[model samples]
Target: MKHERGLLIVLSGPSGVGKGTVRKALFECKDTTLQYSISMTTRSPREGEVNGVDYFFTTKEDFKQRIAENKFLEWAEYVGNYYGTPIEYVEKTLQEGKDILLEIEVQGALQVKKAFPEGIFIFLAPPSLKELQNRIETRGTETEDLIRNRMNAAKEELDMMDAYDYVVENDKVDSACDRVNAIITSEHLKRERVSNYYKRMLEAE
Candidate 1:
């Protein structure tokens, strides 16, 4: 039997929305066949961040060259650092019938939507703006000025939540992961997917 193409699950939100935390929990809580797409960046690696695992670290020139060659599914520059998702790996993974999760920001997610409209877009949101600020401050990773800037960006990103197929509130990591898992399961059972499966079965028979 021929397997159907895997789902492209795009999980995106503003900074400090706990998208990463929820994604990690989803992986741990489910035995689903999924792969996490590792993004490429021109920024220097942080402490304890492995080269290939955390990000595919590259030089500014190399990253720009790839962008010129249209290698990225989506690319963006934030805080003077270039970050992008390489298209090759993601396409190969989908063709192999393994779902892939892309944990990205709002802008990149929109870009992906244009390139691959079939992908499932899920927006992770904070319970409230105040809670979002608290989460950002709690991280202690950014300066006051940077935090403020992120908050501004978050506001703009939150406004785009309607564009996503599903909006998941990240009030609690476990609950958020549960919602995400449910969405993925539901997407797999979508009419289009089921119809393809049914057609394949009839052909085989």
Candidate 2:
């Protein structure tokens, strides 16, 4: 059977929500193609982070210039640093009929929704606030203030979950990825391309 070309998957979650892990799992499926949008940031890349792969690190002036030119689909400042999705690359990827993934925060997700009305968004959530707090503490270097701030942010993001098309609980990697995979499959089946293909297959009857 012929399937739709690919998917535009937008994934959002707060810090320590294990979105990265789930994203990795989702990318492992053989039939699916996944690409993360490289968000430009004013913040410097940390140790071992690649220049373009992890993020497109740029200076404040360059970021501002892009903003002035309206080159970004969406942009936001966080903790004294700015981050944004470059419009040119995103449009190019979508134009190619390939799957595109954006693993961004809730704020960015909302901005994406405004630009791409048909975009599919999924929210990854921890089972509970306590589980979320515990997951954050597992890193073992958080200060009291940091922990509290992260917890508060999680609550804020969770409150906006309804805005997403699907919400998957990150209780288990396999199960979570399975749910996401199912969603992508179902969406592909819903496309008009699939119906057309089915019609062709039935012509012999």
Candidate 3:
């Protein structure tokens, strides 16, 4: 059998679009070979969140130092904290033939697109702007000012949805996850990937 390179899947969306929830549901599928790329963040861990599992929690200074060293594939500051994707881990995982999912903000996602143009970019969107506002408000995680800032950012992100390869409506978590899973499955079966496998088989024969 010919070994194939793993697919890089980038999932991005506006805040309160339920991207995190959909990602969690996607991992529940036992048949998936997908791995989650743990992002590095300078924010304090929330209740029930574990270090290295949820995020690689670090101090702002350390995170800034890493940024200066060009260690991150993509990174951005949201609200008051820094979040970034470490390039080394992601490259190593993909080399091991495991598809990895990166759930990040729009700015980071665009940065990844520039760095890895072969990646499959998926945009998770809310059913409506009104619904998105409601979801953010219901979470009660941020103050009014922060929520307003996020909403403005969301509007700008939505305008860039055309740049993504796929757009999944996150009205229902299960349904959104289903769509994302289908996309990954289909990407694996793309003509280019299958053609490479066939070529390798012919070469060996």
Candidate 2 lDDT tens digits, 90-205: 88877777778888878888999998867889999898889889988986767788889878888888999989999988999999999988887777777564787778779967
Model 2 lDDT-worst window of ten: 1-10
Off by over 4 Å in 1: 46-48
Worst 10 residues of 1 by lDDT: 24-33
Q: What's the TM for model 3?
A: 0.96
lDDT by residue for model 1 (16-102), tens: 998778877777755767799989988878567788886899999999999999999999887578889999999999999889999
lDDT of 2: 0.82
Clashing residue pairs, candidate 1? Answer: none
RMSD of each: 1.7, 2.9, 1.2
Q: Would you list the clashing residue pairs of candidate 3?
A: none
Q: Higher TM-score: candidate 1 or 3?
A: 3
TM-score of 2: 0.84
Question: How do the residues 1-205 of candidate 3 rate in per-residue lDDT, one tens digit apiece?
Answer: 3346788999999999988789888888898778999999998887787998878999999999999999999999987899999999999999988899999989899999999999999999999999999999998778899899999999999999998999999989989989999998898888887887788779999
Point to the candidate with the largest lDDT.
3
